[model samples]
Target: MFFGSRKGSEHNSGQDKVISMDRFRDGSSLSPIRQAEAYWTALRQGEDVPKRSQIDPRGLENILSQTFILERIAPGIARFRLAGQKLNEMAGMEVRGMPLTAFFTPTARKQVSAALEHMFDAPAVVELSLQTEATRNRPSQEARMLLMPLRSDLGDVSRALGVFVSEGNSMKTSQRFNVTATELRPVTPLLKPKMSPASKSPNEVNAGFAETQAKFSDEPSVMDEARALVEASRQSMDEARKSLSEIGKPTEKTKPSRSSHLRLVVSRD
Candidate 1:
């Protein structure tokens, strides 16, 4: 009951713009793949990758059964953190916690791992065409799968949004798919907004400090005041020198001769 598988088929791999649903034929059974992609794209809203938390199942109501979320545990390896009913039916059991490679043939597992690595490393969008072989009681089936990078709550590109849709009758047994073609589209990050300069104020001084209220004046500078003080000091020093010179010289020796010629009387004490 597995999907169709063929050997020696060339894989069509390319880098292109975001895929458009209109590019596929109208009423294609794999349209759900494109629908899921479209939902992820809309969530991007100009971002390189949409946040995993931004994913709302309500937006994907129509294709919810085919959508799953993946958490990258290592390079070239990812496991299903959340899977839809279709995946469970394909695996004939709950597919949660299972590696994505489980859904692919052993030979195709390498290709699937490479695709997962590219989607997470390049942070690109990936689409794969899968085919499963028919058994005696089952018919061959064709499927389309989409993997889009998403940012986790921590802003790391460790999570992905995926959709897997197959065209054919439901299988009672577990199934696996073979990679036939792959398309990779590298994403462009959004540019940050630039900051504008602050507007100039009439007053040159900044407004917050206490000095903001001080006015500019044309008063003498500090050098001018220093020169005036020096001149005053020099004058005082010159006057003090002259006064000392006068005191040092002989002064008015004959002025008190007449009145000072007093008789000297010796008195017994």
Candidate 2:
């Protein structure tokens, strides 16, 4: 199922604005938009943004299929690495590997591209209110798109974590939306405190050590590499052992051929 896979909730009224800080703190609305926002907040914690490797689809199960992950392939260009079924249905195509601009109208593509760049360069979160042009065949739509920067595995701010929600009937044809309104919030990176030379706090040293370990441990690929190496070594040793074991194995003796003793004669007429 694509965009219309699930029946949207009644409260998804599509009229609600991005939740405010006060509303967020007071636990006001439980709309899909707010749910997406809260999940992104929890993932980041105190960091500038969460890393690509840190995201767990299971943790975002509620909105899992409504979310997307994009990677900046070049300046002013982003390709979708993962897209939800809703997005696919809206585009009327498989959206993964497609540029984000593909979903927007020609007139609004530049604006959409600029917003994407700002999300990466400012390392910020952006929320946009979107609407598709109405036609006899396709009805208008009201949608919300949230874009948040994410640290790539190589430590660059080139990945985007996004969630999209729309309140309306799904279109029969591909939909092209325009950004009606946008809100951007800049995020500050959390820096580690420096220790003075004279003080040389032991706690600071321990913290630094733990941080270094965490940097490497956060990527599961490292552990995968180690496991692969161990498995290869074990296989090699097993092969070597088999070769050694076969060296002195006894061999079966063959019976002498009776054909050697038999002679065949042919007489000519």
Candidate 3:
């Protein structure tokens, strides 16, 4: 379960440049913090954020459970949010259920965990900063974060849509950036979108059902709305004219399914 959801922007979308904040290169234009927000806005608008099912692995669900999509996934731990290519060369691995503390320098670990805790406890989108020693020998590195909550069918905080951005200056005469700061934000499950149900079965209320779902509505959070969507999805998938009257379309197909929250994935060397 990806904590934050969105797709990749591997293709040159020109949107990346919109958030680059080149003026920050001179330390004269934007604060690293502000730059991160601008970048996040661009990504959210570009529609480049990938969903959990598209990129992240299942083992991410454990620590992910304690967090909603509106919460931060933290800096050191393996993060499930699908981000852009700037982090491509980034390399690390995770052992399921491990707290992020085990993966960072002492100072980095302490500061980051606290910042993250505050973000989660409040259960709203918040901005926080942290220090890390994970860089290629940099003395001090700052990261910025944006944590926004997503809702499932239960009317509670379910997941989040997040964004992470690093700030830096362009190396003289080159395109390389020497990152000095980073930022993150949660975007989705914020404004509701039409829910796409995984599977549907009618007359089997206790049978396979949607674990999370929601209907399209404004001024509403989806966490509790998932139940309604599940029922609608059930009718849409298995019932004939009922759905046609609701959606003006005929039923497709409904199949039995179950939820798998976590699993291990091995790769061949």
Candidate 4:
């Protein structure tokens, strides 16, 4: 399927710095996930996350079963949490004590290497189609995989987390996420009369550059920009927060529709 659903994750290894505690304590409007989101915002912005090895597996185990299949895929690879016996069997046999390279057929192995490398190279989520044992060695029935990086507090790439989402005949749609934002020089054509530093002089061209330079001086550093980009992600994540709120709202006894069953996955890179 060309179109697929979007997935997300939260990094809660560190203290809950990013979350809003007030609303949560009173159990007013904000939910646990929302409060946890604050922690996630800080994590995304480069706050130190405890090493996974240092983390209590049991502490996260309950969250894992509720979310993804949380076993290590290889030396530095982990699969997004998956459910059911099939996933467990696959992990048990080849992925646990092995490098991910072991699972791919030789030709596919090369591709897997490249894909995993790409995940390490960037902090964005990547999607691809892959063959699985469940496919019966046939060409069709491929599982869609999304590779995301999990990082350490030092801002180094830690583990690459991937999700193998199955797509049947139905259509799939994947939402695009902005992992990083670059500082770009403004070009005239795309320019609108947005707010700029106050500078009025006869020579407009030189004045514009001078003003831009000054603005940059007062603006965020590269590190701060990184923080903003991560904080900005909260806007995108608000959708999930809203869903959780609706779920928590008291209502007549009824199971929510699959319309709300949309699954969102995130590889903490």
TM-score of each: 0.59, 0.58, 0.30, 0.33
For the record, the alpha-carbon RMSD of candidate 1 to the native fold, in angstroms, is: 18.2
lDDT of 3 by residue, 19-48 (tens): 444554445343433543343344343342
Local distance difference test, each candidate: 0.83, 0.80, 0.41, 0.42
Question: Quick one: best lDDT, which candidate?
Answer: 1
List model 4 lDDT by residue over 1-269, tens digit each.
12223334254333333445565545435332333323333334332322333333343332232223233345434444334333334444323334554544555655555555555554344455555443333333454444444555565655543333343323222211111211211111222456554544333345434443322235568999988999889877998799988997888888866655667898999
- True-structure lDDT of candidate 3: 0.41
Residue-wise C-alpha lDDT for candidate 1, range 1-269, written one tens digit per residue: 22333444354333222456653544445478778777787788778899999999888877788899999998899999999898888888898999999999999999999988899888899999999987898878888899999999999999999998875336558898889999999978756556332444434565554455455566898999999999999999999999999997986566554555778899999
Candidate 2 vs candidate 4: the lDDT winner is 2
Residues 1-269 of candidate 2 have per-residue lDDT tens digits of: 11322246575555444434675553336566678777777787678888889888877776776799999998888999999887887888899999998989998888888888899998888898999998887667789999888999898999988888876345445888999998988987656668565466433334442442222234568889999999999999999999999999987888977665667889997
Note the clash tally of each candidate. Answer: 7, 1, 30, 17
Write out the backbone clash pairs for model 1: 3-132, 3-133, 4-131, 4-132, 4-133, 5-132, 5-133
- Candidates in order: C-alpha RMSD to true structure: 18.2, 26.6, 35.6, 42.3
Candidate 2, residue 213: the lDDT equals 25
List the lowest-lDDT window of 10 residues for candidate 3. Answer: 169-178
Candidate numbers, best TM-score first, in rank order: 1, 2, 4, 3
Off by over 4 Å in 4: 1-86, 91-94, 132-139, 167-269
Could you tell me the lDDT of residue 261 within candidate 2? 69
Where in model 3 is the C-alpha error above 4 Å? 1-81, 91-104, 134-139, 167-269
The global Cα lDDT (0 to 1) of model 4 is: 0.42
User: How should the candidates be ordered by lDDT, best one leading?
Assistant: 1, 2, 4, 3
